[model samples]
Structures are given as C-alpha cells and as structure tokens.
Target: MIHHAGLIAAFMDGGWRGALIQGPSGAGKSDLALRCLDSGFALVADDRVELWTSGGRLYGRAPETLAGRIEVRGIDVLPAPALAWARVSLCVRAGTPERIPEPAFTDDFGLRLPLLTLALLESSAPAKLSRALRHLGERR
Candidate 1:
C-alpha cells in the first residue's frame, strides 16, 4: 500500500532499519527526515512511502518516480542517497509528545511497529529518535 509517509533508515547491526514518519501536511515530516539524514540516516522515501509485508515484518521504500529525492519545504526538491528498501523498525508520529509517554505501537500490514510521538521541529528530535532506536535495540 502507498501511504503519505516519509521513510528514513538508520544503520544498525550491519543493516538498515526504517523509521516511518507519519503526520498531516506541514507537520514537519520532511523536516524530521532531513534532520535524520544529516544525523547519518539514509533516506528510503520522502513524502510518500510504499509499504509491504514480508517475513512477518513491514518494509518500506520509495516509489520509482520519487526515488532518491526529498522535498525541502523552503527549497527545491533535492536528490539524496537512498536505499531500495528497508525493514521498518519504528513509526514516528509528529505531534506534541509527552515528556514521558507510555509505550505505543502502530499497525501496518498487520505488523505492529514501535511508535513514538515527537515534536519534529525541536532541535533534539533526531537525537531523541536515535536514543529510542537504541533503547528498542537493547530490548530485543
């Protein structure tokens, strides 16, 4: 299925795991993604993501037309380094995040992805996501 989401992949354990960013327009999804990229994550898809299920896990990628491209709100659509696809490990919803929220999950293709709410524009958002991914890795 195609979704209005942005996908960014973080390198971990010699592989890439995607974080699916979802929110309404102007919710800073792309902005968050750019920050993630600047922080060493790879772009999978920006603005729209194609999702599928395989081996009990959800995976995401960019559509052919949008591959290797990301839209920067104030700037032109720019080319970026991207992966063909990635196993999704997390879902981030742009919003007013709780200071210490309960654990949450979001279902996609019957697979539940660990969920985190973040104020995407905050300078610390990318670091928070990196920490969350590390915590999730520790738990597994």
Candidate 2:
C-alpha cells in the first residue's frame, strides 16, 4: 500500500490508464486534475490516492470517503466523474523542478514508473500533459 500527497487522473482513448500527480500541498495537484479533466481525462482519486502493485504494474484508487469528489481550491467540493481504478502509466510532479534530469523514474508500491514534472498553474499545462500521455501511449 502506498499513500501519496497527490491526485491521480485516468485518461482513456482506446484503453483506460492513469498518471499519478505528486507534489507538496498547494502545489496545484487538484487544479492540474481539473485541467486534465477539461482536456479529456477522468479523475481516479483526488488529494489522496491509494496505490498498490499488481503483477508488476502499479494501480491507483480513491479512498471511499474521497470517491467522486474534488476540491476546487477556494471553491466548494464538487462531484466529478471518477474511475474506481486504473493502471498508472506515469507519475507527474507539479512544481518548478530545479532542473529536469535525464529520463526519470519514481517508485511506488515496489513498482517503477516514468516521471515528469510541470508547472501546474501554467495555462498550457493541461494540454502539455495530454500530449505527453499520447506520446506515452504510442510508445507502449
């Protein structure tokens, strides 16, 4: 089991999959999620997500209490479309990463996943994430 300070968003083009978005509190985790949703991603978990490894792949799910809900910053909690689980294909760190090292990887529940970083507040972030997902899907 792995509890992380992040939210997970699942996107489906032909298959359902997800990315684990991690960062310090107020790092715009949920805000990034909202943008992703607008850009065609679905929520897997918000604020807190439960992660586990299954047959060598990492999966993410929302805790029961947080299911289908997301905090919109100063806005009230809102109901959103959500998936019970999804195989995590990547991990996204929301921040001004000092410097992006060469290909990065992060471990969760004993599984390693490709990691990427982005400035979540940027207007183009959601579009950037969507493109990254498309690129990843093509590679896999």
Candidate 3:
C-alpha cells in the first residue's frame, strides 16, 4: 500500500533500516526527514511511500516519479542520494510526544514496528531518533 509518508533509512548493521514518518500536511514529516538526512540518514521516499511485505518483513520505497527527490518547503524539490528500498524498523508519528512514552507499536502488513511520537521540528529530534534506533537494535 502507498501511504502519505516520508521514509528515511539509517545505515545500521551493514544494511539500512527505514524510519517511516507519518503526519498531516505541513506537520514536519519532510522537515524531520531533511534533518535525518543531515544526520547521515538516506532518503528512501518523500511525500509518498510504497510499502509491502517481503519474506515476512515490511519494506518501503519511493514511487518511480518521486524517487531521489525531497521537497524542501518554500524551496525547490531537490535531488538527493537515496535508496531503492529499505526494511522498515521504526514508525514515527509527528506530534507532541509524551515525556515518558510507554512501549508502542504500529502494524503494517501484519508486521509490527516500534512507534515513536515526536515533535518533528525540535532541534533534538534527529538525535532522539538515532538513539531510539540504537535502543531498538539492542532489543532485537
């Protein structure tokens, strides 16, 4: 299924793990993704993501027309280095995250992914996400 979301992939363990960012328009999905990119993450998809199950794992990618392009609001849609696809390891919802969030997960194609609610525009968001991914890796 294709969703209105931005996908960014962080290289880990010799491969890429995707973080699917979901939110309403102008909710900082793209902005957060841009920050993630600045922090060494790769863009998997922008604006729209095509998700599917392969060998029981959920994966996602950009649609053909939008591949390698990221929208910078009030700026041009610029080209960037991107991955063809990534195995989704986390799901981030743009919102006011709880100070101490309990364990949460979201299901896609019957696969469950760790969920993190974030205030996307925060200066520390990308760092928080990186830390969360590291914690997630430790648990797996």
Runs with alpha carbons beyond 4 Å of true place in candidate 3: none
Cα misplacement distance, residue 25 of candidate 2 (Å): 0.6
Q: Model 1, residue 39: displacement in angstroms?
A: 0.7
Best candidate according to lDDT? 3
Candidate 1 Cα outliers beyond 4 Å, as residue runs: 137-140
Candidate 3, position 37, lDDT: 93
* Model 2 vs. true fold: TM: 0.87
Going through the candidates in the order shown, the clash numbers are 0, 0, 0
Better of 2 and 3 by lDDT: 3
lDDT of 1 at 32: 93
Give the Cα lDDT of each candidate.
0.89, 0.78, 0.89
For residues 1-140, write the lDDT of model 3, one tens digit per residue.
Answer: 99999999888878887888999999999999999999999999999999998886888999999999999999989998999999888889999989998988887558777888999999999999988877764554
CA RMSD (A), model 3: 1.1
In order of lDDT, best first, we have 3, 1, 2
TM value for model 3? 0.95
After TM-score superposition, what is the CA distance of residue 29 in candidate 1 from its true location, in Å?
0.7
